[model samples]
Structures are given as C-alpha cells and as structure tokens.
Target: MEFPSRDLELATRQATLESDTPQIVGPQVVLGQGGFADDDAPENALVAVRDQSQWYVADSLHQARELAGKVQGRRSSLEPRPPLELPEGDWALTLRTCWVEPAYLETDASWCNPQDEPADPVANGGAFGGKIASDVTDVARELAQANDRVVRVLWSREDTVRHGPKRPPVSVGLRADGSGIFRLARTDHIDERIRPLLPKCEIEQVTIPGPPTSSAIRGAGWAEVEMLRAGLSGQAGWVTAPSGASAKATIANELISVEVRAGSPLDWVMFRSYCIGAAHMAYSWVTSEGLSVDQNGDVHDLTIRSFGVLRSSDTPEI
Candidate 1:
C-alpha cells in the first residue's frame, strides 16, 4: 500500500531578522518521544488523581480512569434549562463552545518533591490556555510534602474534559448598520476584551450554570463578532489579535482559504506548521469537533474520543 506524503512549506517573511531552524524537539515529537511532564517524573514517584469527588492516590492509568468514572457517576444530575434566547436583529446567531477544551495529548500532569518546587504542568506542547489555572501543581506539592515522597499528580481524560476551561458560548445579533447585541456566557473580563472590537454592539454577560469559560481560548469573543460581520457583509472573514497578528479566511466549495500576517516570524518552519495547525483547528471546530453538553451545564462527552475531534485521516489538506 502506498501512503500519500504530507509536505511542509516555509514561506518567506517580509523581513529577515535571523536564519530559521527547525524546532529542536521536532523529530522526537514526530517519533512520539517528546518529554512530557508525567514521563519525566521520578521512577519512585507516587501517583495522584482527582475528580469531582476529591483527590486520591492512584497506582496506574487504568485505576485513575476507573476512579474518574466512578466520581462522574456519583454527581447529581440537574434539570435542563430553557434554550438560550437569541436577540432579534437582521442576523441572529447562537454558538456553543462545545469542543473547546485544549485536549492536549499530555493530560495535565505535574511532579513535586519534598525538597523542590513542583514541576511545570506544561512540558513541550501547550494546553491552549486551559492549564493556566490548573491546580495539579499545587496538589502535587501538597501530596509530596504530606507523603514525604516524590509525587506525580495527573488528570485523567475525563478529568480534563470536566475541569478544563472552555471558550465562552455566545448569542449574537447584528444589524445592517453594524450595531447589535452580543450575549455571552458569564466570564471574567470578557466584556472588556471585546468592547473595542464591537463597540456599537451591546455586550451582555449573562450568568449560566455551565462549564467555566475563558476569553483566553483562541479569539473567544471577538472572532464570533468578526465572522458574523463578515458574513453579513458578504466579505471574507477578518480577525485581528491583540498581539498585532491579523488573518483573513474565506470559505468556498467547502474549502477554507486563510491569509495571515503575524509580522516577521522567528522561524518559518514553525510558522508554517502553526498556520497549518490553526487552519486544521478551524476546520475541525466547524465540521467535526463538538461536545454533547446538557442544557443543565453537565458535559456528557467525557472520553477524549467523545469530543468528535477529527482524525488525521479525516482532515483535509491545509
């Protein structure tokens, strides 16, 4: 059987500051040997796991997953609430951050010893800001000191799905004059973050009993607004980040073409990879990825596979 080859292209930047090089760990990562937080733990380190119930000791991955399932089964179910009300306008939209968890391969992990500070929760790959407030490091340190031994605190797949921060779901209404209403799930600083982007739109931050939300998710509040405005105007979607990076994307015949200018990238190889990745993420989020959450705010998709992430075979050429 012949397999198709995937190629990488390094486009020239507008300005050249330094010669670019492939990431040092690229080969290791491709070969599945990147040093993750848990893999770097001491051989003698004890394992710890947590869920809604509480933190507890686990001897292995299987045991940890089993414990998490038990904890999930014990939580009380809530009555589903009424559907979100969409504001009336020329264009009304309601969007959910269903498949928004970072779901990084290395489910939150950290290690700590009695004599040293806790290991960093993030090792090589990032968690898309989902791990910014993770308590695994603190728990690892506490367990290590109490047990007087090296300890590795890890989050099971279910735990990550339940505890990770999600992109805030939003309801938007846009008028022909570019003024409208934007209703967002309650989250910190979300209004301030998006005020400048859609100043004419009335931003309403509503409290809902759902998974915790964060503006840190890739273009959480503003991206929705930009896409809506672009769609309404029959123009390509345009988005600008706080870091001065900007991108435009358009969809035709089921293909999304994107153009980005992030200003003089440090590494063209990494830049190309990131660009392709972002495109893939956008494609998957729209077509394949999503979580099944109840109206009561309980997440029904607990397993990593349940989130409907697009597999490599199912992904389109980017």
Candidate 2:
C-alpha cells in the first residue's frame, strides 16, 4: 500500500519545531489516532517560565500562533461563557471535486426511499447526502415545530458513513449436484439500526445483535456475494459448457475450484488484472462467441491536485 508521503513531511516539520520547546501544559497537548495533527488541548498555565518562553509549535506556523492565542486566553483567569449570538445566514455550498461518477447514482438510489418525505422539506439534503434522510427529516421536523423558522440540513461524507444506513452483510451456502443445477441458501445479517431506516424490501432478513462498525461503506456486502457466486460457478466449470442438453450432462460430472487470496495491492494487482481480462473474455464468449475486441473502450483518465491546511482550532469535537 502507498503511504502518505506529504503528510509525513508536514509531520516531520512540526516535530522539529516541537523539539525546541522544553515543556507544554497538560491541557495544551492533543493526541489523536489518525488524520491531521492539531494542538487544541485544554488550557493550563505554564510554570517556571523564563523571558523567552516558547508559546506554541504546530504543524502549520499559522496554527502555532492561533494556539498561542488560545493558551494566552486560558492562562488568564476569566469566567467561562458561550457565544452571545449565533451566525445567521443562507449559506453557499461547495462540493469536493473528487472522482465522483454520475453512474454511481444506482448506489445512492438503493439506499434512499424517494417516497419518504424529508423531515425538513425546506432543507432536503440532510446529513451524508441523504444517507440518513429519514432520521434527519425526523429531527428537522421536531426542530421546525419548536422554532418556526426554516432550517437547512447538510450532510458531509464522513457524517453519511458514520450515521447513514449500511447494506447488510450476507453469507451464502451452495451445494452442487455434480450437474449444472445447484441449491443455494443465503443468510443475511441485517443491522438492527438500519431496520427502521430502510423501507420494506423483498428480502427477509434475520436480525443479529452485535456492535456493527458505522464506517461500513456502501455496497460492502454485494461485492462479497458477487465474488462467492463467481467463484462457485467458475469452480463447477459451468463457463465452458455448451448450451442445450449436452451441457446439462457435463454439469454433474465437472469439478469446481474456489480460491481466495488476501494481499496488498502490489502482491495482487497482476493477478487481479489477469482475472479481469479472463472475465472480459468470458463475457465475450457468452454474448458474441466470435467477438475478439472490446466494444466499450476507455474514454479518458484525469487527475486533479489541491492543498488542504488543517489548523489545531479546526479540529472537530468528537
């Protein structure tokens, strides 16, 4: 896997600056597991300070100064107070320019129920791009009723993954009769949290009690099912069999192989490419027996670069 080179460089620079400081207050240090580093620690007074006492050292120089201001405020004894007024406005929106494909709409549609009305119809795009539309709507309706003002709802990608409904994981058991015919039994472990979130679907699900990670991405389950189905069918040698009665006779007599490999990108990329090429060949064989070239070719590949600066003060309140 490719490591974060740019992030490491910034971290190294911050470390060099931090080494200059002899000591930091307990409340002025923040420790995080991953992502950007920021010093948003609670305020405490520095003891035994000399004339040249270092105030702040941060990943970003600007952030260091911001931390100095925070530390200064904390050191000065003052009564704790909240903001007197909240900022009021109809905010402008901007989306991150990521590799988002319009064709990916299928995944979004599968997760949301169009018939279900948003809780705050005025602000329809609720958290996580409608990943929790129902829940958001419910909250918005309640808030709107209490405060007779239009409330706008917005969802960040992170929020969507954290709180949005997830696709349930499924396990399938297949028994082949040494013939083309196979018996399949599927068991799906549906998340109880998502039961209330999703509209009624055709599949009957069994609820399992456990702590499911909220970071489960979209189509998390379908990929596994597709892999299993492909392997099972491939093992049975169903791909090579001719159509009609002859194919039926060979189905029961054929042997199938199922192989699973877990590895990093460098270890598996070549194998993955070979598998994809084979799959395309198989598709051509099934659809047009003699077609040798790809019909839908690659259009274009594009890359964009940008810079993101994270300050200690900008850290999210978890």
Candidate 3:
C-alpha cells in the first residue's frame, strides 16, 4: 500500500500557517489518520483553534473560528499556556495500538492438537495483509490529546521532523562463495528512539527525550526491524526466485521542500542505473553457467545481485 505523503504535506502546511498568526484567525484543519491500518479506515480530520487562552478542538473550521472570536472578545481567563518545547538532538515520533477478535471454525485439521472454534466467520488478518495495526489508534489518540490541550502543541516543522519517529536505517551483510553460492546472511536495524519509549509497545515515541514532545508516527521499532529484514532478504534473492517478491514503502519527512527539489533528480538517476545494471548481471550469470536443470532439476553458480531503483516519473511534476 502507498503511504499518505500528500496528506502529511498538506497537514504540515496548515500547521505552519496556523503557527504564524498571533491571534487565532480560524480553525486550522490538519488532515491525516494517526492510527495504524487507517489507510483502509476513515482518516482523522482535526480542527484545532484557541479557546479561552487554551487550545481546543472545533468540529469544523467555522466552529473553530467562532471559538477564537469568543476568546478574543474576553479580556482573558487564565494566562495563555506556554508553548511546548522542542527536543534537542535528532528525534522522531511513533504511535501504535492493537485489537483482536475471534471467529467460527468451518473445517478443522490439526497437527495432533485440538481446539474449539467461534461460531462466526473470523476476519482475522489485516485489511492489507499486516499493514493495518495498533499504530493508527495510538497516533490518533496522541493527536487528539495535543489538540485538546492535554499535551503541548507541536509548533514547527523542525520540531515535528526531528521529534517524530524516523524510519530506521538498516545494513545487511551477505556472503557467497567464489562461484556465487548463497551462504550466511545477517541484517541489522537500529531505532535510536527506542531507549525513551521503553516497555511501551504502543508508544508515543520521540527521538528527543522529554515530556511535551509525545506524539507518535505510524510504525515503531519492531516494524522497522521486520521491514529491514524482509527488504534485505528480498534484495538478496527473493525477487529473482521463480515466485517473485515485491515491496512498497512510504518515507515521511526525510527532506525539506527546498532539499527535495534540489536532490531528487540526481538520486533518482543514480538508483535507476544501479537497478538496471544489477538485473542485467544477475540474468547474465544465470544464463551463462549452462548449469541449468539436470535430470534432478538443479542449477549451480547462481549469482544474486543486490540492487534497486528509486525512480522518478517521466512527468517532472511527479
């Protein structure tokens, strides 16, 4: 499934605009779902505005503006709450939650173990395989809390990006004999944010250590590690197998608007060339060895080339 990059971009833009004005002009409508599996589910539509010197949720933009007007009319209630402080050093946010239900059993066959079944058909898995999970709900709750004045507001893009859950970078080690026979494979992934959100599987993770910056992103440490393992495995050999494998990823907040325009083309072309070269080499290796299938249907000297592409669309606007 695709990531919600467009929605996030729009929301970030709205947040920036709202932060600029001193008085609450209108409700700021930030769009995006917070929880896991929210892609197939309804997206959370948040409208935040000032109310009596504190932030409050307005169901709609109009309602938010009305509340802001009322707050302006009043001289003052309690002093305005202090702005939330951003964390120092790089940080990222992550959110997650989980739910489970039982279903009936139609037919049963077991490996020497017996079990009872529910009466109704169980729709057990996620909408899109394992894509949907608790992370969505966790993020939703965090956003709601921030909007409701339970937590301090996130005021800037730098704060949001640095303090949010970052996509963990990964490294893989692969070994093969001189003839390209697969051997040992090892994968490593590090979530620099993990230390702060200790013991909380469903967490409002932040790379920066502190209280005010407690919002969540989509997947946390486990997801990053699992994805890295799968990705490295696929890179090593899965994509070339008779039964091919594929992957889809959505990266958020990696670059500023300025950097995206400046860096995308060079990155894209280099990656594309790498993929083409790798595919060609793998194919050539497989064909040249003539060690195709014997009577036993076995082949030798198979070389799996690890390479990939991050291509740009032909349309420059893309």
Candidate 1 residue-wise lDDT, 1-318, digit = tens:
232342222222211211121213345556866666776788877778776878777666557557655544222233223224777656644343443555667688899998899977765545666776778899998999998988889887777777788878776777776678888788887887778877788888888766788877666777677767676677765577666688877667756677997776655565666777777777777677666567777776776665667886777655
How displaced is residue 262 in candidate 1, in Å?
2.0
- In model 1, what is the error at residue 7, expressed in angstroms? 18
TM for every model, in the order presented, reads: 0.81, 0.25, 0.21
- Report the error of model 3 at residue 275, Å: 15
lDDT (C-alpha) at residue 299 in model 1: 74
| Weakest ten-residue segment in model 2 by summed lDDT | 298-307
Lowest lDDT 10-mer window, candidate 3?
A: 104-113
Candidate 2 residues lying further than 4 Å off, grouped into runs, are: 1-133, 155-158, 177-206, 209-224, 235-318
Per-residue lDDT of candidate 3, residues 1-318 (tens digit): 333323434433332332221111122322323221212221234443333234444555456557566321211122211111322222233111111001101111001001211111112211111211213233334545445422111111221122222222212222221111111111122223332323222222222221111112222233333333344344421211111223232223541111111122223333333334333322332222111112221211121111111223211111
Per-residue C-alpha lDDT of model 2 across residues 97-120, encoded as one tens digit per residue: 111111111111111122333333
Q: Pick the candidate with the highest lDDT.
A: 1
Model 3 has an lDDT value of 0.25
Which whole-number lDDT from 0 to 100 does residue 90 have in model 2?
28
How good is model 3 by TM-score?
Answer: 0.21
Cα displacement (Å) at residue 202, model 2: 16
